[model samples]
Target: MKTVADIILHNGNIQTQDGFHPMARAVAVSGKRILSVGSDRDILGLASSHTQVIDLDNRLVLPGFIDTHFHFYEWALNYDSIDFSRVGSFKEMENAVSNKALALGEGNWVLGQGFNESDWPENKIPDRYDLDRIAPNNPVCIWRCDLHLSVANSLGLKLAKIGFETPDPEDGVIAKDTSGRPTGVLKELASNLIRNVLPKPSRAAVLENMQKAVGDAHKFGLTSIHDIRLMGGLDGADALKAWQQLHRENRLHIRCHVALPGEMTDQAIDLGLCTGFGDDLLKIGYLKFFSDGGMGARTGWMTKKYLDAEFGMPLTPVADIERAVLKADQVGLSVMVHAVGDRANKEIIAMFQRIESHDRTRCIIPHRIEHVQMILPEDLEKLSTLKNIAVSCQPNNLSLDISMIDSCAGPRGKYAYALKNILKTGVPLMLSSDAPVADPNPLAGIYSAVTRKRMNKTPEKGWYVEQALSVEEAVKGYTITPAVASGTGDCLGSISKGKIADIIVLDQDIFKIDPDGIADTKVDITLFDGRIVHER
Candidate 1:
């Protein structure tokens, strides 16, 4: 008995992602899954004469890209906020802020993101006085490109309830002016003071934005995404409920793997919610823990304090993070810790080792350390032994962190975003955009991974020339590796029999082109469940 195929995509250079079939000419689909992948004759044999045949006419096709770490709400939030990401000068930034404030009516907080002081002509972070002169009564909060640092206006500080008497929290910074008054520059955990006061988006807004994000993702050749932080807590249970509501109403499109935050991890576990608790539409990813702050904010925990800084590395003491990982593991939740600096990576490796010894790899939890930036050579070697422990690294960091890297790490800045070093360690590497932090463009990320060039197109041989990965290796990070890390490898990553038919067609042969040209390649078509989601 033969299974009847519903759709057949013929006459294309199919990059299987699977080692066995590396390249093929066609693929046949039945309903929502791949029925067969081979020559046109082989596929046509499985397809009925009435089946729809999509003529590729000699194009390049590959598995849909998967992002292992991204923030859905943060990306969607930009749809309604002032975007200052392109400001090249303080005057430009000032004008944009002032104009936006004047038009925003009264009493509303004028929020914006993606400002990098290093790129500004004056080399100065805009202060409260600059904002006060523009907006006056309206409060303002402008986030640094990393999304880890922010500068607030005096009114914004007051709204966040900060005062001269306020003490900096353990993991955050309150940058004050020379006169001892709050200048409104906040770092790491301190920025949350204002974030906590901000209004939560209504459920209607979440559904709308998530849909928009999914549509945008498909246009970029993305089929699966792992959302790192869900703003409304409890595994972002409220957000998931809304998504469920949308899915039930037949409105949802993309596949989401939610990374439950530490704030809601205990409660979720207590409620017996474990990893992969949902179906193909939505599922639990990992138990996310912040072992350290971000690189751009200069807050990533380090073995040694950042050079010349008064405060040493800010970290979630090893004991605290370890306890959390251990507990989550006991209840079948995989741990995904953000470890950027050497000390942070070392501590997280220790936590994984402890869990590996105790749990003996039960249920194959894809425990991973996010960022894994600036890791010690020893820790990388240590990570190689744990089969289930993976690394989700943002290759685009090279393009975005050049200035922050130079400012914070000096010459070693070259070693900061080492994707190749991570891959060489034998641990599976996953790729992501951390979108809103970086655009969710895998081609941009892959280009950065291979060339290591910053936005200005500087650095001919890349930051650390020896650490640049080949284009083939970079594709695996965006495809099968992330699928494996997210626990959907068996069903979603490859274009093979029994795998869900999620595919993307490219207009150019990225593999055959020069490393720089990879960024210029465009997505021609995107499919989910064998149905066209986006076509260009």
Candidate 2:
């Protein structure tokens, strides 16, 4: 019996990402998998009268993008939150919060996020008094773009029961005024105090919002994501439950690999959960751990002091991380640690080396280092030696952090966001948006990676042009490399026979355009599971 394709896309420029057959003119999709990829004639021959054949008109088609580090649950819930991503000054931020407060009418919580003081003219961190002045009657809390810090109003702080008398929690900080009064600025775990006290949305509301978020993701050509867990482990269980609920309801259009919090290693082991535990639609991913905070917050556990002469702090001690990694490894669960500073990266690399030395027998999935945001050259060399290790970097963050890193790290900024250098070391480099921290659009990420510049195209020559990746390399970072990280390389990365049919058609050829314009490129069509999920 001849196998007939359910759908056929012909006369298209398809980037298969398979070395042997790197490019194809057409593709045939049967059910949820690719049935054939070849010249237009070959694929068109597989189409029967019932097949839905579409002429691509020479449009660019590529594998669907994969965001290896995304806070899906968090982003979905904050869909309606006030966006300060474009706010330019302290007054602008104040006005935004004030407006939200007035609209919600007193006593309701006014929550906002994605404010970066570094981008503001004032160049000063907002304090509780700043928020209190604008939203006095209503409790207000706004997060820094990096999410490593947050500022709340006095009412918000009082509601969380945090005051000068309250001591900082482990791995967190409560900034204080000169008079020793609470300043409403919380760092790391301290922000969780307010988060825990905030009223959560109902499960039904979350699911509805998540479905909308999935739709938005499809617009950006994202067909898969590694739904990352936040620090403090507050959202891990809920996040996993949400994804599972979406799956059970038959509403999960995008593939997801939900990570388990490192703190829950024992529970996962007891439940017989390991990496890649579920089906293709969803699976258990890495055990997530944090080695330090973000660079923007000056809490990234650095080897040296910042320009302000302050050394960053570690959220989790190196020794503690090593112990957890070893324990998780013994149970066949890979770990992904968030390391932002040079010291943090160095420590994590050494820890992974130690693990490899002790246990070379287990068939463990490749462990990962998230946000290798900053690292020394020697550390990069050391990282390359670990055969079972991969890296997930956020180019979108590089666009957000260029100015902040230049100001904080100064000369050492040369080593920050070295995408090309990291690639040279022979380690698998997966690109991601780290969404909610930065924009989640893969094109925006690709632009930043290739241009090493902000969306505005500043720094005419580009930031450390030496570190920029080529277009093909950046695309690989979002495609082939992420597939390897998620342990789905054989089935999800490329447009090959027998692989999952997750692909997208672009309105413009990103590879052929000027790198600066890549950020503005749009996805004209998106196909997930061999079905057209989105059409522009």
Candidate 3:
């Protein structure tokens, strides 16, 4: 008996992202997998009377995007929080917080995120005093755009019990004034002091917000994400539980790969959890480790002193991370280390090389370097030599970091965000948003990668034009490469026969449009597991 397709989309420009059948005019979906992909007539022939047949009207259809390093749990929880992503000055930030504080009433915590001082005209980092002036009665905390730093108001600091006498945590710093007073600027794990005190939303509220966040992700054409864990491992268990609960309730619309924090390596090993341990919708990803902080905070460990600042500090010692990686690797779990600066990337790459050489029988699951934001040419070459490693870079962050890097690194900025160069090394390069830190829209990321400019398309010639990728390369970074990174190359990344039918139709042909317009492109329809989950 001939298998009938549940849905047939014909007369479309389909980018399969599959080597064998890279382009197709139509695709037929059977249940939750692709039944056939061919010419219009061939695919339409697979449709039966019960099949839902639709004409694509020549729209561009492609594999659903996969964000390899999204902080989904954090993004979801901040769904209701104040957004400072668009604020242009300190005055605007203050007004925004003041408004929120007024609405939430006195003593109520006011939490917000996505503030980049680099974007402000003053270019001044917000401190506790600034927040205090705006919302003195409220315990307020706002995160820098990178999540590596946060500023809390005086009330918030008091509530967190942080004072001038509070010693810096092992991997964190609480900035102080020259007068020996706390400045309210928390870096790395120090933000946990404020986070630990902030009220957590109920589990039910988290699930509800997560459901909304899923819809928002679909709108941006994201069908899958690697839900990255933060440094302290505070949200690791809760994040996994939320995903599991969503899966159990059949509400998990997006494919998720949940990462375990490196801090939980012992616990994960004891529980016998390995990477790729779950079903398709949700799977255990890598054991996430941090080598250094973010560039925005000027805390990204660098080989040399920044032109304007001191050499940044390491968040986790290199030797400590290597030990944890070895333990996890022996048990079949891969590792993803966050390395943002040249020194950090060089050290982490060497660690991976050492592990590879010392253990010939290590797990096949590829370890990854998150935010290879800056890499010396030598480090990039070394990274390429590791057969069992991948690098996840964020172009959206590239859009955000260009000016910051230029100001801090000077000539060394040339090696930052070297996307094209990294690809030349024969290593899989995955593009992701690192959401809540940067915009999550895959289109925005693609725009940044191809244009090497902010959304407004600045500098006219583009920054580090040599690193700019072609439209095809950027698209592949979000599609096929991510599949390869996640060890799901065979089934999830492309539109091929017998592959999972996670696909999206775009309103415009990104490949044909002007590069600047790519960020404005929208997803017209999203098909997840062969079901029409979103239409706009």
Candidate 4:
């Protein structure tokens, strides 16, 4: 008698994202592994009366998404915080803050995030005075969308102790008016002062919040992610503990590859940890390093000055990065460094070249660069020819940064987000949303990559249309490429025999839809570990 399969998904347009079995009409799952993938007739032969069979009704099925770069742990906790993303005008922002403050009442901290004042019609960053007028009794701290800058109300500033004469810390800026009074805008490491003053969430709270995020991720077809750190490299230990507890309790449904801040590289080394240290469900990923601030905050450390601003600044000196890379790589710790500007990218590339020359086999996983958002064409050869280096780009950011890049990068914008060129260079370019920074929707990423246009589809011809990727290539960014980057290529990322049974069925065939329609596509069913986790 043939063995009965646990579940059989048949009559579907399954795009396996595997080179061997690129397409299939049905797939059989036994336990947590794929039993077989083939035509409906061949797969049905393995199913018995006890098996749960599903007919996809011609829907599109593919491997579950893996976000190469995500701060979803932190984004999950921000549910209680105010969300000011896409606020059109200053009046709207104030109104939103006023409502939240009223809800929280007096003396309570009113926390918020995702305020991009640059996109507002007024084109002005709100000062402490603007927040004080509306929420005088409550302490308010709202972070910019980029997470590199924040604005605090007077009460919040007082709590953080910024009453002028406080020297700007190295690698940080405390924005102030001419009279030397802090305007309540804190940039880079300066935001840490206010963060230190704010009440911290307990570990239990973090785990609870992460459970909610897991449930939410299922609905969006995300089965795995690389949990990255927040700015300034704080709380890596605490965050790891939270994830460890969640995994031990068997409450963690998503596969997590957690990256530790480079500051903790020594601790990781002492603990005998290296890349891919844990089991399939949880693993130690990379030693994450931030080389520069974000472009959204005009602190991306560009090669040339912005249209009106100073040459952007480097958040971490090259010496610190080089030392960490050398030490970590010697102990088999792969590095995932964030580089968003041409200068940062160029500098990091040089550092990687030096390391590659010295020791090529130390790290188990070769170094990767996160958000290769900008690179001069002249320097493309470094990233492309280097077989060991990988690149992770977030097209979702392109949707939010089209205007910002144009304004800030000016004519040099040609070199910004040159994803297609990166792909041609033989570099493994994985797609990620960056979550809280941009919506962590893989479909939205595909839309942006295929269109090179913002949400509104401005610039009728598309922004640098030449760089747009085909549907197949864009889809690969979220699937096969990321799977290879995370070192799960053999077991995940496709519907193939012996691979993990992680799949999602979409309401629309993304390849058949118009470029604009990609963002509107929805998931109808999601299966993780051979079980139906989401259905709509």
User: What TM-score does candidate 4 get on C-alpha atoms?
Assistant: 0.98
Instruction: Give the alpha carbon lDDT tens digit for every residue of 1-536 in model 1.
Output: 13888878899989989877888899988878988899989887877777888889889899999998887756775677777667788888888888888888778889988777776768788878888988887999998877778899989999999889888976788988777788888887788888888878887887788788789999889998887773223226665676678779888788887777777777888889788888886887777777787766777877765553532354567788778777777778887888888778888898778777775555465788888888777877888877668898988866877766677667766557778778887888998887877768899899988888875566776777688889989999999888877778898888988789899999888888888888878999998977888999
The residue-by-residue lDDT of candidate 4 on 70-165, one tens digit each, is 997778879799888767778999998899989988999998888766667787888899999989999999988778888998999899898888
Candidate lDDT values, in order: 0.80, 0.91, 0.92, 0.86
What residue runs in model 3 are displaced by over 4 Å at the alpha carbon? none
Model 2: residue 89 alpha-carbon error in angstroms? 2.4
Candidate 4 off by > 4 Å: none
Runs in model 1 deviating more than 4 A are 45-50, 230-235, 305-312, 359-363
lDDT tens string, model 2, 1-536? 13799989999999889888999999999999999999998889998889999999999999999999999889999998998888889889989999999999999999998998887889898898888888889998999999999999999999999987999999999999898899998999999999999999999999999999999999999999999999998999999999999999899999999988889988988887889889999999989999999888889988999997477888788899888887778778888999999999999999889888985535357889999999999998898898888899999998888889989999899999989999999989999999899999999999999999988898888999999999999999999888976789999999999999999999899889989999999999999999999999
Clash pairs (backbone) in predicted model 4: none
Which of the two, 1 or 3, has more lDDT?
A: 3
